[model samples]
Target: MSESLGDPASAEMNATAPETFRARFETSRGTFVVESNRAWSPNGVDRFYNLVRGGFFNDVRFFRVIAGFMAQFGINGDPVIQGSWRDANIPDDPVLMGNTRGRVSFATAGPNTRSTQLFINFGDNSRLDEMGFSPIGEVIEGMEVVDALYSGYGEGAPNGNGPSQGRIQAEGNAYLEADFPSLDYIERATLVGEN
Candidate 1:
């Protein structure tokens, strides 16, 4: 664990601290809440918990959003933090829950590759279960806000007209705002019970 994003030592110490927690995201679209259960995906939940506590998702854009597919985000606004978390992979969790609509899970390129990126399913995506995507949480409120997020750019670069993950990681929000201005972004993310 590195301290680039925040106090990694403290995050590690709190890794096993909670079995369940709720995160509230205040985004440009609207507000939504995700209720995460560690029992479903311990490592994923822990990582998300720490990231929220560390303010990693603040001002992070929803860079990849497809109408009926999913909406993705979680790259840090700061390029350095994004770079640091690029390879900070967490071990895979068993698929205890399917990737149904509104369910949130860590996005991965492959096994054990989940770092800071995550997506909320827009429709039933049970196929992703076999591919090893485990849902750590689900939207307990404001699913409409998630659904209404801007998807005008469609899929990201190399796939569609949207921003590229590589560029996002390298340039952060500056590149997104310059090129993809309509993209929605999180204004802040905070734990439900925390100040």
Candidate 2:
């Protein structure tokens, strides 16, 4: 692993380094792939490798959706998908980035609870950081597809984890269920600006 994996200065040097990323979401509706832009990735390939090594984002569906507000995902409610690196939460990276529209951030139930769960901001939410929100990346494209998601409630409704109990709550309850996008899959994610 590159020492730059957690270094801030080296992140910029990685700018010229080729980078690529791939994320998959498994929901009650179906599984989908989400390609990410690495040109703007703060830590470049190092961050990408860290995410893959975490293995917490794998097959985890977006579990929360608040139209025009934000869309949260990453946690599968299974113990396997929860917690941070080494079971120790990474320090909050807020202020390093802004919570602008289309920004993807880690979700924390509280201070440093961030682990596998993440959220995409639908609007400017600067106040979020004051509340401990940390955005990791921004969406360079695909805003159109994200906006077209169906906003509905109930198990497997169509929008996201549904309204009644949310994905986290429905994880163990056999009576509850959730919904998510249909046929939504990431085509591919490759680093930009690298030769």
Candidate 3:
């Protein structure tokens, strides 16, 4: 049977992830692997795991690729999917690790606001730990590919010229393809060992 794809509030979306597992992300640039440890952040890991299993990251853009900083993505390109997850907030996972280079953590608006967006640190961003950015995993392979993802767009709108998150959520990839055509995107993402 196919895996059930549901909103975060549903039981299928909340199913527990493995104690340790790897997720392979195939992007426009190349493929990379992130091995997540549930012990570090169970809630965050489970959400990420289910999203991959449910094929949620297909065609998602690396919208905010900050050179020498991090590459952020995970916003669904389908506005319908985006709307379903917009208010599906998950409580903050107590940060158990620092935001070192290659570490992955969910992006948040504030406390308990983490939903789908996440970033991969390109440098030591330990300072984020103090602000509650709990890392669920780190890139275990193809760090160079992660390093090479296009970053010419810089920061998101109002601050810089990159695509605005609100617009991406509202208009989906149509807005991105028209305005920011050079952005690299995830072709697909998958669990490493799932049958």
TM-scores of the models, in the order given: 0.94, 0.56, 0.96
Model 2 alpha-carbon drift over 4 Å, by segment = 1-49, 53-55, 77-88, 154-195
TM-score of model number 1: 0.94
- Alpha-carbon deviation at 135 in model 2, angstroms: 1.6
Please list the residue runs of candidate 1 whose C-alpha ends up more than 4 Å from where it truly belongs after superposition: 1-14
In terms of lDDT, the best-performing candidate is 3
In candidate 3, residue 43 scores what lDDT?
90
Model 2 per-residue lDDT at 110: 74
lDDT per residue (tens digit) for residues 88-162 in model 1: 788999999999999999999998999899999999999999999999899999999999999999977797888
Candidate 3 on 1-195: residue-level lDDT in tens? Answer: 124554567787778999999999998989999999999999999989988888889899999999988999988898988898888888899999999999999999999999999999999999999999999999999999999999999999989989999999999999999999999999989899763
| CA-only RMSD, every prediction | 2.2, 7.9, 1.4
lDDT of 2: 0.48
Clashes of each: 0, 6, 0
